[model samples]
Target chain A: MIEEITSTQNAKVKKWQHLTTKKGHQKFHQYLVEGWHIVSDALAAEQPVVQIIATGEQLDAHQRELPENIETFEITPEIAKKLSDTVTPQGIFAVMDILASETIDPETATGAWLLLDRIQDPGNIGTMVRTADAAGFRGVVFGNGTSSRYTPKVVRAMQGSQFHIDLTHGNLEDWVKALEARQIPVYGSALNDQAEDYSTVTPQADFGLILGNEGQGMSERLMTQTTTNLYIPIKGQAESLNVAVAAGILMFKLNQKLA
Target chain B: MIEEITSTQNAKVKKWQHLTTKKGHQKFHQYLVEGWHIVSDALAAEQPVVQIIATGEQLDAHQRELPENIETFEITPEIAKKLSDTVTPQGIFAVMDILASETIDPETATGAWLLLDRIQDPGNIGTMVRTADAAGFRGVVFGNGTSSRYTPKVVRAMQGSQFHIDLTHGNLEDWVKALEARQIPVYGSALNDQAEDYSTVTPQADFGLILGNEGQGMSERLMTQTTTNLYIPIKGQAESLNVAVAAGILMFKLNQKLA
Candidate 1:
């Protein structure tokens, strides 16, 4: 039977609201996925979706598409608004479990991995994850100081690519050492005298690419650990390219050589 | 002498606040550039910075960087917060005049040009403009249905690249006709049977690249007018690339051939 949640104070409703924060997400081991597109992608990928919550209108519009086994809750418009991050609530959301099984043992890892160091903007972090997926990256490791992968904004911007790709959180330095021990080249994106032009390095089937914080490039210690650093040359007066865009260019260009 | 604005309702303060909206920006032919990095870039580029407004601390910290001829204002904290779009306000802003004189005569245009069609995200729009600048594109044109170039969010994301490149507004269909008349090749970023892999086509010194709306790509009419459409192949399960990221990849790759 489909349950109805008329009060925002209901235990389930309050618990769902808690998913909005990192601490709550970590404690509950769940995050909220909003909008039809994302929710549909989650279902298609067979991710663990705990419950589908929606307003009466949204339930009527999309109930037919949902799996029969999943629990459903009809919530009030007020409750829907409280749970939504966007101005116009899509009125549909899914409580999804974090991919706890996808953690990588870096010593055993191979193929291309994207390592992010303190990427601050939720949109940039999400876009890089999605781009890494599109470029056929094996997995993504969110280094220290990076935004939480399960943050509502990051989840929204990732557009379900998170389900298709492996994501793990760890110290990037340790991951670098592990990959290096496996004889995989760890490339750092840094612009300095010693950095080689990205075009000069051919993309390999197995490698690790490290991108850095928005304001600061890769930390000096991390850069020192890289096998080599790469830089994208700028021909015009603009000082730098948006980090996400740079990541995209590098990912695709390197992957293109493999093709 | 530096004027002071203690009231949020001060005439100049109110006028500056209005620039935050698209309609007001169009009516006033001005926009606000915030943050020291962007404001300083605007000043260095010799763009028409009508006035420099800052908190007393900011004014004291950056007074030496200001050009001697420009007018200055010290605004109250409340007024600064009212004018800022960010959470932690930078407490610095420049009221910059729109480039009313830089409209393109497409028939006589030469070198590379980036034409955008109905891109809605301010961050995406501004990042594309900045990317175009870094790739040494001659200009950027905002087509019908796109976000306003002078919106505060767009201006902020652009990071003062607007000062380095020629930005204009026009009907893309008209611009297409004009470029075709001049025998300049026009490329559309679209995925269709006729579209070629972007890697196959060499980037030319003089060409046009048109990117489209986030949800719906370039309109059918505009696609029909292009010399050729290009597609960046995705190797993994992800559906499509972020529009700004795709543009960056294309711009730099095409520009690399030029180098």
Candidate 2:
């Protein structure tokens, strides 16, 4: 049934607003995905979309893309604006349950995996997840200090790649040990003399690539535990590459070796 | 000489504020670089630092790094906040004159050149410039519709690489023709049947790599005129790579081919 919400104080509107915060997301086990593209991607992937909220105009424009079986709410433009974070609201949003069941056991992981070490930026974290999916990596592990995967900015940046890959949150130190115990070589990205040139390393079928915080890079303690630390050589004057760009280059290069 | 300016209404303060906007930057032929790292980079590169502004604390902390002969201003914390766009003011900024004199003539361009086609995001534009610098590209040409190189956000994201390379603005169509006439192969990044895998192409000493806008890839009219269009193969489900990440991967891969 289609319902109309005119007041921001409506129970359903209040509930959706709660999903915007981390604590609210945790309490309810759901997060909001904005815009038609992300909402449609969730529906297309058969992910659990609790409800879709949009203005009458937006619903009319995207009726063909919306699944008939899913419940949807039509809100006034003012209400839609209150639900959005963007300056120009797309006027569409999907409430999706957190995809935590797909989390993998590092001890039994068999394919390539990406380990993000305290990555702080939502855009960087999301882009890395999307790149990991493009590289055909089996999963992504978010270390302790990283941004929450369910944040609106991150979900927007991931572009629905979360549905295509396993995403988990855990202590990176333990995960590293687990992967190593399974014979999956773990490589940490760093910029020191001890770090081998990334291009020199041969890619393998299964491995763990660890990327660290943007400003500080991989923690020194974590670097010591990896099988080898790799560095991308700078050919020009730029001191370093953006963390996401660096991650993409490394992921694709290593994946190419297996191909 | 060091001078204290307690009021935001000071003539110099008013002028510096103007540099924050596009029209002001154009009128003064100068742009603001924030944070200690970028300011130091500008001074170290001798990139025509017009003046430096900082809170007394920042000036004292960075005394050793500040150029002794350059004009410096000591501003109050309130004034510093007013001059900054970030939530937390870095308390340091440098007014650097535009470095457009180094613009290369495409017909005579002899090194790798990055052509940005209407890329909108300031961060994306800046990261691409830094990546180009790291890849040892000679220069970057800002095509029509690209973000202004001198914007505060772009300058911050570039992380001082702007001082290390030549930045020019011009019509991409004309630039492409000029580069081609000089036998400098121009490559357009696209996802289409006619596009060759980026890995298959051999890197050359002199060439132009065109990256398109975020939402729309390269303009269709411009894509058709390139010598060859290249594609980065996506092994998994992501629709595409982040523009900056894609540029970085392509740049480093192509640069590696030459090495």
Candidate 3:
């Protein structure tokens, strides 16, 4: 039904805003998604969409394609703007239940896994998830200080990779130890003098590659716990690389080692 | 010299705003820089520093290290806030001369060169430059419709690669033709049946790899000009990658071919 929402005081508006906070996201296990591309991607992934709100114009453009049982409503432009985190709202929003996090059952471990250590930028985190998904990584784990996977900017940038990977948030040390316990080698990238060149490292059929913060990189304690330290050699003038770019290069190159 | 700049018409204030425009940066042959890391990197790169401005308590903390030849000024907190593009000014700003874009004579291009075709995000462009620099690309060219190299955000994101590479902005088609004339293989990344897997095709020592716009990717006309079309095989659930990340994978892998 085309329901008109004009008041900023609407319960839905407040709930969407709450999704912006990590506590709200964790407590409710839901995320707010905006724009046509994200909404379309989420639906196509068969995510448990709690509700769909569209502007009158947007509904006219898209209603014919929506599922009959979907909870859809046509909201006012003002209401849509209030619910949007983007500078230019696309006149659509969705409340989606969190995708089930992938369980690290050792019995099913066969491919590579990506571990993010305190990656702070939401955009970088989202891009990494997208790249990891494109490269066919088994799953992604966010360490302490990492951006929340449910942040709006991340959700927008990820497009739809959220549903495709087993995403988990935990302490890096504990996760590495857990992976170690399972007989998986844990490798962390370091700018250390003696680290093996990243291109030279062979990817284990079952391994965890840890990427660290943009500034501090992998913490000293975490770096010490890794079975091996990998370094991407710099041949030109940049002292370092953007964390996401470096991680993507390593993930793709490491995958090649298997082939 | 401490000067209270109340009027928005002040010469220095006007110059700061002008740097935002391409015409202004071209006329002055320099641009504004913001924040501590960018300013520090620019200084450490030993670029020609025209001036440094600081304000508030942070100015006191930063003043002891000011070099004699470089001009220095102190602005009121209000003035600094007005001049800053960022939400929180880090009590520092610098004006540096733009490095002259020296053309890479075609005969000397013995390594991978990045040919960007209308890539637009400043952060994406900057990140690509840093990655290209790290991968030992000969240079990075900003083709038609690309963002200016001197934009503050691009310069900051580059983290000083601008001082280290041949970053030129001009006719991309002409450059493509020139490289082809020299028998240097120009590989265009495109989605076409003619495209071979990027890993399958060994890059010639003399090669120019072309990247396209973020949205449309390589244009049909540009694809026609390529010596060959190459594709990075996507094995996962995501549709595609951020253009810069894709470029990094190509640049680094292609550089490895030469190594």
- Lowest summed lDDT window (length 10), candidate 2 chain A: A99-108
TM-score of each: 0.97, 0.95, 0.91
The lowest-lDDT stretch of 10 consecutive residues in candidate 3 chain B is B101-110
> What would the per-residue lDDT of candidate 2 be over residues B1-259, giving only the tens digit for each residue?
7999999889988888899899988798898888998998888888899889999999999988887788889999988898898999989998888865756677777788899999999999999999999999988999999989888889989998988988898899999999898888899999654699998988878889999999899999999899999999888888889999999999988886343
Judge the docking of candidate 3 as incorrect, acceptable, medium or high.
medium
lDDT of 1 at B84: 96
All-Cα superposition RMSD per candidate: 1.5, 1.9, 2.7
lDDT of 3: 0.80
- Misplaced by over 4 Å in model 1 are A257-259, B192-194, B257-259
Docking class of 1: medium
Instruction: List candidate 3 segments past 4 Å from native.
Output: A99-109, A257-259, B1-11, B22-29, B44-48, B56-65, B98-110, B203-205, B257-259
lDDT of each: 0.88, 0.89, 0.80
Report candidate 2's fraction of native contacts. Answer: 0.75
Highest DockQ scorer: 1
lDDT of 2 by residue, A1-259 (tens): 8988899889888888888889988899999889988888888889999899999999999988888788899999888888887888989999988865756677777788899999999999999999998888888999999999988889888988988888898788888899888888999999655689998988988999999999999999999999899999998889989999999999988997443
Predicted candidate 3 versus true structure: per-residue lDDT over B1-259, tens digit per residue: 5654566668888887787668889899878887767777767768778888777565678666667668877766776777687787776788878767545655455677898898899999999999888888878888888888888678778887876777776576787788888888888997434588887877556688899998899878988898888887776788888898889888887887554
Q: After superposition, how far is residue B117 of candidate 3 from its true place, in Å?
A: 0.4
- The superposed Cα distance between candidate 3 and the true structure at residue A60, in angstroms, equals 1.9
Better of 1 and 2 by TM-score: 1
